[model samples]
Target: MPESGSVELVWLFGPFAVYLVMLGVYYVWEGKREEQLRQRYEEAEHGQ
Candidate 1:
């Protein structure tokens, strides 16, 4: 690890942080799309 006052930590963690953010956005979007499709077909929550 570099010194506290150095910029190495940002370089190391930046890409990982960006990846996590993108992953979260994708999951949320996919979930919403799935819900819309399920509702369009009138599917029950528990298959009842």
Candidate 2:
């Protein structure tokens, strides 16, 4: 019974941990993409 309980706990927490990690990665990627877009816009405006 104790072993089964431990396995269940691991199953629940494992996905939660993976989700948090992926969320952090997504946020960083989005921030970098936005920065690149902003720089391109600024360059375009100056070229005009």
Candidate 3:
């Protein structure tokens, strides 16, 4: 059987790692979309 400390460590760190990964992906996706929107707005303003 696994020790309680090891089990607790796994549970704690596992979710944290997953959350960090998800946050990173979200940030990248949001940044790209924002940049695209800004470019489109700029182009529209310039009548391009």
Best prediction by lDDT: 3
Better by lDDT, candidate 3 or 2:
3
Clashes of 3: 0
Ranking by lDDT: 3, 2, 1
**Residue-level lDDT tens digits of model 2 in 1-48:** 579989999999999999999999999999999999999999999999
Best by TM-score: 2
Model 3 worst lDDT window (10 residues): 39-48
Cα displacement (angstroms), candidate 1, residue 39, comes to 0.5
Each prediction's whole-model lDDT (CA): 0.88, 0.97, 0.98
- Model 2's TM-score against the true structure: 0.83
Question: Taking the tens digit of each residue's C-alpha lDDT, what string does model 1 give over 1-48?
Answer: 668756777888989999999999999999999999989677665566
Q: How far is candidate 2 from the true structure (C-alpha RMSD, Å)?
A: 2.2
* Candidate 3 lDDT by residue in tens digits, 1-48: 999999999999999999999999999999999999999999999995
Q: After superposition, how far is residue 4 of candidate 2 from its true place, in Å?
A: 2.9
> Which of 1 and 2 is ahead in TM-score?
2
- Look at candidate 3 and give me any clashing residue pairs: none
What stretches of model 2 exceed 4 Å from their correct place?
none
